[model samples]
Structures are given as structure tokens and as C-alpha cells.
Target: MIIRYLGDSELAQVRRRRWRKVFYVIDDDLMRLDDDRSVPEDYRQRLLAFRQKRLPDILDLADVIVAPNERILEGYPSKKGERLDPCYVTVCDDLRHFDDYQTIRILFPGSRSHLNDLAFLQEGLLRLSAAHTELEIVTYMGANAPVRLKGMEQIQHRKPLPWAAFQKEQQRERFHICLMPTVATPFNQARSINKLFDCAAVGAVGVFSRGGPTDGVIADGVDGLLVDHDVMAWEKAVGFLIDDMARAKTMAQACLDKAGLCGNPVRVRDFWRKQLDI
Candidate 1:
């Protein structure tokens, strides 16, 4: 059983080899690659070319198709005789519990591709920084600390690390809040709930965009706050969480509880076991 993650350039080559049980995991809706406003122009153009030239051949060779969620499957074209069997495998990382700290540590753990999303919260974040002296911004994955955030004294930037190291370091650092702002584009809409789980694993309350991929997972005002994709709404949510430390802590704990039960590693392992028939 060969498990193929998205973005592997050698899929067509793999197909030529005729491997047994080749499963392709579609992490994002590649059909909307053109609509991704966050990716660099050259990279996006190259990706579009690759998809156009190689996708049909790869699809013909794939035995099973997997997606992060049900919604992502809607992006694929329907097959005539052969039904496209799309499996939903959510991102399930290990869960971690941490102690709350004095300073309000906010995190934006996205790659450079999240430029548009981060831009949406620029004004709100700046306002938050100005109002709260204890606000600290931690960025990773080559995500430059927003220029608007440079004026703030408490901004910290860590170079990107391997996924395993990131999880360990994130839990150890124990940021209070995780900001996950998204735009209303096709690429953004088809995103998975990975960010929600990433924040939950670190015992951080996630402030996400309303009606995004995480809508069904996060209960607004309960485990997390889901606000409209606007600066004012983001500011209000951030301020509300900052002013009430106790509530923020509670929300963080609640997030961990929900994610632990629903997105446990055991569950993910079992899913893989059943899917792979190991």
C-alpha cells in the first residue's frame, strides 16, 4: 500500500510503475489553485501548469482517492464508469496540554501561502498590540512577522521546524491564542480543519473565520470564537479573549477536551488500519 500525499511531483512516474494499491491524498482543492491569493505568482503558475498537464494521467493511475474532508471531494470531476471513491482523513496530530502563562501569547502558524489571510487581520492585530502591552506575536513556517506587527515590542519569529519538532515546541511554549484568519476564496473555502486541531493540540484557543472549513468542528463562544472575516470583528474577538484570561484558559481546555475525544491519535491510527487493511 503506497500512501501518496499531495504535491508529490513523481505521481505520474509512480503510476508508470504500476504499484499495487496506490492511494492519492488530496489535501486541498487543487482545482482552485488559480484562486489561491496567498501563494507566490511564479509558484502558483508552475502549480497550475503541473496540474493541467499531469493530473489526468495521475487520476487514471490512482487506485483510491482520499481527501481531508467531504467538501474537498466536490472539487474533483466526476468519472463516467469508475466512481471516484474519496476518503475523508482529517489531520490528526498528537494532543498536548500546557500551563497558561502571564503574557497573552498569540500565534499565526501559517506558511507564506497565508499572506492574504494574515492581511485580513493586520489592522485588528495592530490595534490589539497597541491596546495590550503584554501581547506577543509568534510566527513560524517562513511567515514573516507582519510589518504592522514590527512596531510592537513583543514580536518573536522562529524559523520553520520539522512537523514533529513544531508540535513539541508549540506545546512547550504554550501560546494562549492561535489566530487563523481566512479569506472567502475557493482555495480557502476548501481548506481542512488542520489549524483548528493544531491549536487544540497545544491547548490554545483558536480564533477562526466564520463559515470556514472549521465551522462544524468549533462551536463559536464555547470551545473557540468564530468571527466574521473583518478587522473589527477580529479585534473584538481578540480583545474579548485577552481581557478575560480565565475564560481564555477555559476555552483552551475545552478545545483540548473536544479534540482529544474526537481527533484522538488512536482514532486516526484505527482509521488508517481499516483503510489499509493492515
Candidate 2:
């Protein structure tokens, strides 16, 4: 799948060939190419040029546009956009459930692009970490993470790894809960539920933002918890799990079951078969 924006020669070559095209929309490039400050200015400018000149044509020529989520597909001008369901094959054998554990480890995983999202909910996270000495928050965001979470004894800052390395490494560590907070931005709105898959891999129950990506899908008090962006709301949502081990245990199992369904070998095989038309 051609996820990245193509160069001039590559575009020409693709245009010349009479082949089936599947364009994977990895990110909301239109929103980020110019505005994303995390990227270097020179690289951003070059990417913006490519996006402005070649992106429309790429979309126009694509036979299928594989979007990460329904929101992205809906916002996309192309009707060929298809939202992909994530399949998790790499899971940890021994998961540290909330039971028998004094410290509740909450994984707050994100990348450079998600700094703003983390920042938005930093206050709530700060309060939670401060109030609960037993609650530990783990993040792969490193020094780029929220300042509020810094210097906290419970907040762990792991060195960011490459995608492949991270996938393998994440399974090695055990987490009780996974925190997924999304800000209501165009770029964030277009994101996929990959975090849910990550939670599944580590056997952690998810606590995602209600109006964000987890909207309408996650059953409240069942597989996961859906919360608003409010400071108290986040604290309350996480605190519920921390206070009650039984509820957390049940939710973790339910969330694992849900993730199992998503990662079913036959289901994944069928999805790809249909998507690839093979």
C-alpha cells in the first residue's frame, strides 16, 4: 500500500502503469503537512509541496483508499475510503491483572504528534498521580510528555522505540490499564483505534475519551470506560478501577475478550481477503 506521498518520478511511473491502486491513508496529511510543528521546517515544506501538487491526483487515481478509521473516511472527499480494523497477533503470555497488585500501572502511550492530546488531559493525570501513590502511569512519550507528569514518582518515562521494536517490547511489560485521551482536533479525529489494540496486546483495560475515537463502540462499565475530557471525569474514571479490583478484573477480562474477537485469525484473514480482493 502506498501510504507516503510519492515523488515526481514515482508518481509518473505509477500513472504510466495500468495497475490496481490501494492507497493507505496512514495519517491526516492534509491537516499535518503544513501545521505540524514537530516535524522539521524543511521536511514539512517539502512534504507540503508534494501534498499540494500530488495528493489530489493520488486520491483521484486510487482504486481504494484504506483509511485508519471511519472519521477519516467520512471526512475524506473520496468515496472509496474503507476503515481498517486493527488485528493484534503479538500479545503477552503473562499479563499482570489488577488482582494481587498494590500498584495499578496505567499505560499513557503516545508519540510526538500526540503531545498536545496528552497536554490537554495533563491536569487530570497530575491530580490522579498525586492523589494515589499506588497508581503508576507509564508512557513512551519520554521528555516530550506533559510537564505536569514530570518529577512525579509514579510517572514513568520510557525511551521511545521504533514501531517494530515498540510492538515487541510493549508485550514484555505488563500494564493494568491503558489511558487513551484524544483532543477534538481534525488530526486527532482522523486517528484509528490502534491504542485499543496496544491495550489488547498488553492485556490492559482501556479508558478512552468518550467523544473521541472510542465513541459509540466501547460499552461503559463493560469492556472499557468512556470518559469526557473533563479533569474530574478522567480522575473519576481511572479511580473507579483503582478503588475496585473486582470491577477492574472483570473489565480487563471483557476487554481482552473483545480484543480477542478483533484479532481472530479467521476474521483477520477474511478482512484482508476482502480488502485485497484475493
Q: Write the per-residue lDDT of candidate 1 for residues 183-270, one digit (tens) a residue.
A: 8887777677778767765568989999887888889989899999788989999899888877887888788776666566676666
Clashing residue pairs for model 2: none
lDDT of 2 by residue, 111-198 (tens): 6667776777788888887788888888888877777778888888887889899888877877888888887765677677677778
Worst 10-residue stretch by lDDT in candidate 1? Answer: 80-89
lDDT of 1: 0.70
lDDT of 2: 0.74
Q: Please give the RMSD of candidate 2 to the true structure.
A: 3.3
TM-score of 2: 0.84
Error of 2 at 220 (Å): 0.7
Runs of candidate 1 exceeding 4 Å displacement: 1-20, 36-38, 79-101, 141-145
> After best superposition, candidate 2 residue 239: deviation in angstroms?
1.3
lDDT agreement with native, every candidate: 0.70, 0.74
